[model samples]
Target: MDEVEVVVAHSQRATLRVGEVFLKVDVDPAHADVEVRAMAMVPVPTPAVLWCEPPVLAIAAVPGTALGVLGAPSPASPAAWAAAGAAIRRLHDAPLPPWPGRKLDDVAEELDRECAWLLANDVLPAEVVRRNREIAEAVLRPWTPAFIHGDLQITHVFVDDEDRVTGIIDWSEAAPGDAMFDLAILTLGHEEHLDDLLVGYGDADRDVIRAWWSLRSLTASHWLIEHGFDPDEPGCEFDVLRARMPDS
Candidate 1:
């Protein structure tokens, strides 16, 4: 019998690994549907779907280790990061998904609500929240939308020993959105690798990427806490906010 390894679990979803296969269980079947559709459409490497039955989607594990995890140093080489960036570039160049992404006004409204919640809850210093919120405003402007892995966290990217990208996982959040937003998510809390990534992704607006870092961190902190994740961990969202402080 294969031993079960719990990858992640929250009220909304959970992932478990059993040897070479991963089983993702979601509260909403629509999320699995989106993942299946998005994976099939992407130009980059992705895990193979073995089967899907409502809330449970089974996939064969891809080769290579994850690019990195939040709150920890990544052992992947600069070339590996660059390769991941190139893969992302390919995805961005692909045709937009049929569905529409969040409107800019919706994003701004959500940011406002989240910021207000952060302030009302006293999750961080008011100054930290204020500064990051100010920084977050830069990403609120309009831009050409591209197919984006909406939750392109570092852990979603995989690379092999020779510094080549192997696969990207977790497509539930994939959609049409700001390309810089995906870049920002990929480098969140690992800002040192941004230059290496840009080597493969081509030039982009660094300020907008930075703005997304702030916006994403601010909007995500509350949900992370509620989901039983610790965003305050070193090199994580809280630190990302603190680093934006003038004195830091």
Candidate 2:
């Protein structure tokens, strides 16, 4: 019998792996609903749904290894990254999902609230937080929404040995959103691959992409800490924020 492996566990949700199947248990069924719907609608490859039962969703694991992981250099070839970019482009070009994404105003409010919390808790150096906040301002403007993967972290992408993108996983955050935001998340800790990704994704606003990097890192730090994640690990969220400093 295959041993059960805890993929991830936290206050809100937990994922477990048994042999070839993964079971995701969430506190809210809505997230799983969205994930199931998004996976069904996305043009890109996704994990196959084995079954659905409210809080728990079972899915067959996709082939290939994750594209990369945060805080570490990706061993994937540039071609693999480009293929992932191409896949993302297809997703973005697809028709919009039925649901509207977070409004610009709401995003700004969250950014402000998270920044304030960071300062109040001294979670990051004042200067670091302030500078990143400034950089984050660029993303406040409106964007033509795309069918986005929303949380397209590196770990969500997978590629075969030949460097072809095989599949992407984790669709709970999927929605209509800024395409650049997804691009930014994919390359969060792997900035060196931006050029490679854009090669297949086509041109993008570099400034907006950079801004989302700051915004995402800032907003996510607090939640990561609360959820028992170390955003300060080398080459993670904290490093991404620090990179915005002039001297960094």
Candidate 3:
């Protein structure tokens, strides 16, 4: 067999690797205001350290699984979040530490700043950002702080024929904070998953989920404007993320 180096680009960054094991790196050109912060690993129970040195890095054991989407979502409809909530729940269950990552105030502040920046850039209006800031602050306030698989979208699931999650990757944004934020990410991205993972989460009011989902959407929309991309024609799912946020 022959090996060639290829560059794989995700929403926030690109990965360059070759051969059986490919190293995927996520780069967010603008760190000041980002939605998901480019995940190198998904939300799963897999135990591994998620870190990056200016540029993101992920050394995968799979032959070419490190490639873009790793052939996820098949030939079409790759938008559906293939990652399972149960897997994310397990990730949340992982015994972690309450260091800076777990600080509730920090999370809230970051969301507020992103929203503020987006509003300033004309990506989002003043009223929308203000409302979103309120919602974000509320969600992060008084939270017990559970492990959040930062970027919980369809491709993260990594499933099989039975629809069972085989593995979860993209943990770069993984942090200890409000679980609602992560839950919102899953629900908003995968409508079908909302019900699928209800059992895994044990049970929660639908209204509660809505608030978090809305907050997540509002916070994520900034990624486009921050990158100087046209928010109207983002040409990707983040636009849907922006649309799903709804008006205040």
Candidate 4:
């Protein structure tokens, strides 16, 4: 049973809670609750089957509004970003079931489908869509996969007072693939706050992190182009992604 009533719809797949538990929809509402929440809770929040229409998904989750107001307001700040990075690291360290492939070539079909689906649905651009396909092929060729929050960026984080990360919401893209892919999103998403985050993380080379960011930069741009997203959107993560690219 859901802990709260759906007070209001905050986004396409997100909703506001009137009580403690937060209800969210990931993919395939009929799938096992465990698979739905494998991306969030550290020890598994234990989602259960319910008779509520649309499956009132029960999971331990945080509010998207709270996170957006605090965490995203200053993703470039040191204190703000460090907390964000650490939260991400903790998430990356979490165990997940392995998927079929680690090599870019292996997941090429899936990646292509994602890009294609977005494009076909009028969420991506024609010319730029091709770029996303090419980028996926290139990046996955020699990829070392780990658990990745495949759709991370500014909109995913939630922070508390004093600018500490309170929660990292949005697990729709969660998958056991490349850890670097997640790092790349975190790095590019919080470039302004990179220093603050790394201070606690120390001066680790973290090449994979760098690679993930650079590659995602290119791929994300393709997404933007396909979707006709303004390149100059204020504080938009896509601009950061482009700025961080070495070749760009």
Model 1 Cα lDDT, one tens digit per residue, 1-248:
99999999999999999999999999999899999999999999999999999889999999999988999998889999889889999999999999878899999999999999999999999999999999999998998999999999999999999999889999999889999999999999999999999988997899999999999999999999999999999999999999999999
Model 2 / residue 197 / CA error / Å: 0.4
Clashing residue pairs in all predictions, respectively, total 0, 0, 11, 10
Ranking 1 against 3 by lDDT, winner: 1
User: What's every prediction's RMSD, in angstroms?
Assistant: 0.6, 0.7, 6.7, 6.2
For all candidates in order, the CA lDDT equals 0.94, 0.94, 0.51, 0.51
Model 1: residues >4 Å from true position, as ranges? Answer: none
**Model 1 misses residue 96 by how many Å?**
0.7
lDDT of 1: 0.94
Better of 2 and 4 by lDDT: 2
Write the residue-wise lDDT of candidate 3 on 1-248 in tens digits. 64656654546666655553445555553331121242323344332333435455445532112112311223212222333555566666766533335465665676777767776777655765565455544565476667676766544555554555555555556666667667666556344446656655645546556667656666555664466544344323344344444551
Q: Estimate each model's TM-score.
A: 0.99, 0.99, 0.64, 0.58
Off by over 4 Å in 4: 1-27, 30-35, 39-77, 98-103, 106-138, 141-144, 202-211, 217-248
Residue pairs with clashing backbones, model 1: none
Misplaced by over 4 Å in model 3 are 1-13, 17-20, 26-58, 61-83, 125-127, 228-248
What lDDT is reached at residue 118 by model 3?
71
